[model samples]
Target chain A: MIAVIDYGAGNLRSAVRALQHVGAHLQVTDRAADLEAADAIVLPGVGATRDTMNALQRLELASALPRLIHAGVPFLGICVGMQVLAEQSEEWGLHPCLGIIPGTVRRFPSHVGKIPQIGWNQVMSCAATPLLAGIPDGSAFYFVHSFYVDTLDPLLVAGRTDYGIQFPALLHSGNVAATQFHPEKSGRWGLHLLRNWIRSVT
Target chain B: MLTRRIIPCLDVKAGRVVKGVTFADHIDAGDPVALAALYDREGADELVFYDITASSDERAIMVEVVEQTAAQVFIPLTVGGGIRTVADMYRMLRAGADKVSINTAAVLHPLLINEGAQRFGSQCVVVSIDARRVPRSHPTDPLRWTVFTHTGGAGRATELDAVAWAKQAVELGAGELVINSIDADGTRDGYDLPLLQAIASAVGVPVIASGGAGTLDHILAAVTVGQADAALAASIFHFGTYTIAQAKHFLAEHDVPVRLV
Candidate 1:
């Protein structure tokens, strides 16, 4: 069973609906035991990195997540969930994150189109990964974010997209993976990605 | 690159879609969920549901419709029309709405924008402004339009200028702005391009040009000439005048960037 880690930072209703539609047996929970017992884990979040980090800490999952990822637990992070995996974020002035990935999140420059790139944009696969299996190279995904992860390690990049500047849209290392866009909100291509990830672990 | 978004706005009264869609595949033309699913199949980037009903009983039905629609439809769904306070936004979000748009409420208490953004994150708060062009008596007035509170009904014009108000709304943490042209609402001549351009240029966030889309050319004009990030329409798509696929194909052919399924 897949465990969708929820800490009151974002909407898990759509995520649950999307995953169930893909025939994945998953439970949305904030418990540490559930995360440890699950076959695979999906961390879903939205809103500010500060709030998300705080919630994860309050639930006592902040320190536990890095150890789980290091132990090779199949994991997927969405939007702000992916941002919290980074070392730190500049949103509301330098908040520390979980450091599962060696990177810092930075706001997209104001000169680059709009502050929040809130629309469909094409993402191209940068590295081969099971999480992105069967997904096209340049498929459009729904994105609503002002900040993006700037990975220090280049090999972690799995998918990249362009708004004004090219930013990492997807990342993968070992069994851990993440996407900057909301695959739950993206149409069939998104569902396909979720199915691919579930297929990998199941 | 981020492409232009084409949104089909569904006006829902009670639990039914106000303008019946003509899609033969849908079970009921007035069913909002069925229409929304058909639009999703037609490759619509996002869907907006405007609850036109005002009564408390009807509002509950609207929430139920939102829950059912969000369960089936995966794309971003924005609910507008009756959202008044942070509590109203909370109800919509809990009901599975991705975003809540406020028009009169945002104008009445500007703090509602800040409060909603603070609670739900800035990505979910969209301040919709209904504005009409001012009949000019003085040539030197920089303001071309005044903000209208009650969907631009006569005697509803406020002291706020459309462009200035848009900039201020963004500053107060509105992630996006919907500029509705009152003069061109149902007439469908075209979008108020000058009004759209003025506000789109002033704001750093995405601006959706609402009201007055008669044809595919008008949609093209809204994005290209008016410089809007998205074009929203109601009657054209609902009456089967044009499909979202056809509009997107036209945009792609004209060199405007759009997501083609």
Candidate 2:
């Protein structure tokens, strides 16, 4: 079964609907026991990194996730969920995050088109990973974010997409993978990616 | 690069799609779920489902339709037409809406925009302004467009200028603005280019041009001339005057960046 970690981050319902559409056995909760029992986990979030991190800390999922992910259980984080996995973010001043991944999230510069870069943009696969197995290289995904991750290690990057500067759109290390875009709302390609994630374990 | 969006607005009442979209493959012409699925298949960049239901039971049906539609259609869904409070916004968001467009409530209680934006990121909050051009009271100034809260039904005009309201709402945390022209709505002539341009240039965030879209050229002019990020139309799409594919193709041919499936 897949456990979608819901720590009060917005858009959990849409994530649930997408997973349900793909026929995945999923539960939306922040309980430690649920996270521990699940064979795979999906951490979904929207809104600011500060809010998401605070919710995770309040629910005690912030500390619990590292152990679960370190145990080699399959995991995926979307948007703010992925941003929080970094060491810190520059949104609304310096904020600490999970530090699971070695990176810092920064807002897009003023010169780079728009602030909340909202719309469809093409993502190109950077590395060979199971999460992006069947997905095309130049596939467009629905993106709505002002921040992008600047990773310390390049090997962790799985997919790269350009807005003003080339930022990591998808990242994977062993069993843990995440995307900056909301795959739940990205049409057929999004569903296919979720199916692939489910197919990896089941 | 982020391309311009082509959004199809579905004015839903009760559990049915309003104005009745007569698609050949659809079994029920008024089914919101079926219409949403059809739009998604036709490669629409995004969709807006405005809940125009008046009754309490119909509101429940609207919520159900949003949930069902969100499950089937895998694109960004913005729900509008009855969202008032942050709790109401949460209700729709939890039921599968990516964003909620607050119209009446936004005008009455401006703090609702800040509250909704603070709770569910700025991207999730869209302030839709229904503006109509009136005769200028001042002799020096030429522009005279006032914001309307409930135009056409129980119309209430406010002293707030449309351009000023657009900037103020953004300052209060509205990520995007949907500028709807009351005079040009359903006229099928063209969009209010001056109105759209005034607001679009005033705010840094994205602005969606709504109402008065008749032909493909009107849509093209919205992005090219009016400087809108997205063009939203109702009858032209619902009445089978034009498909989303044709609009995208027209946009692409005219050098407007669009997602063509």
Candidate 3:
């Protein structure tokens, strides 16, 4: 079963429904035991990364998460979930993140048209990965966040999107993959990407 | 580049779609869930379900509609109309709505915008403004518009300027602004370009042009001339006058960036 970590942030129901629709047997839990037992893990989040980190720490899943990811457990992170994989974030002042990936989460500069960057933006594939197998390059995905992950390793970036600066849209390493866009909300292309990730992991 | 979005608005009253949807394959046109799925399949960038129900008792019905629709539809779903408090916004967002739009509630309690943003982040808070053009006293004066509330037959005009309100809403943590022109709504002539341009230029957040979308050209003009981030229409897509695909195609042909299915 795929364990979807629920830290009581934004809408996890949408992510759960989308995963179930794409034919994944998943369980939404705050317990770390579910993460340990699951074949794969999906961490979906919204809202601020600070709040997300707080919730995870409160639930005692923060320490378990990095350990699981490092243990070669297939993992997927969305939005704030993806941001928390970084070393620290600049939103609402500087705060440390999971440090699983060597990166910092920073807000989109004022010149990027909008601060939150809400709406459909194209994600251009930078490297070939199973996460974006059938989805076309330059396909638009639904993005609703103020901050983005700035990875230290350029080789891990699977996709890049440009607002004012080129940012990592998708990150891939050994057993972890993350997307700044909400694939659950990106319609057909979004669903296609989720299906691809599930297939590759399963 | 972020492509201009095309949104299809569904007016839901008592859990059912208000307008007649004439999709050939759809069995129940009044079913909001079925209509949402159909629109999603047609490549609509986003779906907005405006709960037109008045009483609080009927509000639960809209929540069920959102829950059912969110299960089947993969695109971003925004719920609006009758959202009063942060709790009301929470109910919809918890029911799987990606965002909750507030109009009169935001005007009455301006802090509601800030409160919702504080809890759910700015991205989940959409402040919808209904504005009508106010007559200019002097020829030398620029075009002016006033914000209106309770956007139906019982509309009430407020002293607030539409452009100023747009800026204030953003400052109060509104991630997006949906500027709907009351004078141009249902006229099918075109969007209030002047009003849209005024607010779009005033605010730093993404502005969605709503109210008047008659033809495919109007949608194209909204993103290009009106300087809107998205264009929302109800009748055009509901009555089968145009499909979302056709609108995107028209915009793409005119050198406008749009997502085509």
Candidate 4:
């Protein structure tokens, strides 16, 4: 079973439906027991940094996540979920995050390009990670964000995407991994990613 | 580098794509899903689905069409017409619409943009403004334009300046703005450049200029002279007269930087 944590930020149903489409049985809940019992847990979000933290806290899943993740449970984060894996964020102001990865989430630098980067962008796989099994080096994924995670080690990035500055679109460390772009919305490329994630644990 | 976009606006009503001449003379084009797939393959940077039938019965059709289109095309999809609240925006996003564009409902209650942006990201909220030439009382200056509601509006007040409205809406958190000129709608004469330039200059967000695109040169003029990030057309695209691929090819040769097929 794949547990998709729904803190009510936004777009949780899409994640759930995408997992189901890939033939993965999933439950959308923020409970610790359900998360621990599942083969994998997906932290999905779509909003500002502060809002995402507030939603996780309101559901009391902020502290429970570390416990499940540390237990070697396969974990995948999507979009804002990828942001929370960092040390902190500058979305509205500096806010503490999950700290599963050593980095900070900051807004993209000012440029002539659109702020949101709202479209299908190519993601180049940089490392050999199980999370990217069958995915090519230049697979287009759906992305929509003004902020991205900046990490201390480039090796943690499995996939890098270019907007204004080339940044990591997918990151993985041990049993934890996250994708700034929504794999659930990235068509065949996204489905391949989810299947790889499922194959990792099950 | 951010490339200028060429968009095909599909007014899907009851699951069918209906394009009009001047927001009238509606004709059935094709299924929304098929048109989206074609646009995706033909190099349309993005696709916009305006729910012309905002009626309750037609809303279901729009949602179904969106789900179908989402499965087929991976390009950005902007949905408009009938989006009134945050919940409505959420529903569309879940259905796989990339952006939710609100027109009359947004201008009527500008805070809707903020609320939608708060729940979702600003990137997901698109505020579309329908403007028309205010018909200068004096012949000296014919550049005055005012905002209107509904399709091309009907005796509504043209008091609001499009630039002012776009500025305020962006401040309230509209990620992108789509401006349509009533006088230029389906005319094929050309986009209202002065109006587009004013609105684009006033707002920092990417502004999409819509209306009066008959030729590929019209798109070039809108992107360069009008200073818009994108040019949107319906009739030329729906009628098979000007394919999106050809338009992008022409714009690329002319150095407009549109995303190519």
Q: Which one is best on lDDT?
A: 3
lDDT per residue, candidate 2, B66-138, as tens digits? 8888878989999998777898898888888889999889999999999998888899999999999987778
lDDT tens readout by residue for model 1, B1-261: 788999999989989998785676645879999999988989899999999898999999999999999888999999998888899999999999999999999989999999999898888999999999998878777559899998623448799988889998999999999999998998889999999999988988999999999999999999999999999999999999999999999999999999888
Q: Which candidate is the best by DockQ?
A: 3
Q: Residue A142 of model 4: what lDDT?
A: 73
| Residue clash pairs of candidate 3 | none
| Residue pairs in clash, model 1 | none
Better of 2 and 4 by DockQ: 2
Question: Candidate 4 has which clashing residue pairs, if any?
Answer: none
Candidate 2 chain B least-lDDT 10 residues? B20-29
TM-score for chain A of every candidate model? 0.97, 0.97, 0.98, 0.95
Question: Which ten-residue region of model 3 chain A has the weakest summed lDDT?
Answer: A110-119
For each candidate, what TM-score against the reference? Answer: 0.97, 0.95, 0.97, 0.85
DockQ of each: 0.82, 0.77, 0.85, 0.27
Q: Candidate 3 versus the native: TM-score? A: 0.97
Candidate numbers, best DockQ first, in rank order: 3, 1, 2, 4
DockQ of 3: 0.85
lDDT of 1 by residue, A56-83 (tens): 8999999888888888888899999899
Per-residue lDDT, model 3, residue B165, is: 91
Over 4 Å off, model 2 = B136-141, B152-154
Better candidate number, 2 or 3, judged by DockQ: 3
**Deviation in Å, model 1, residue A164 alpha carbon:** 1.5
lDDT of each: 0.90, 0.88, 0.91, 0.81
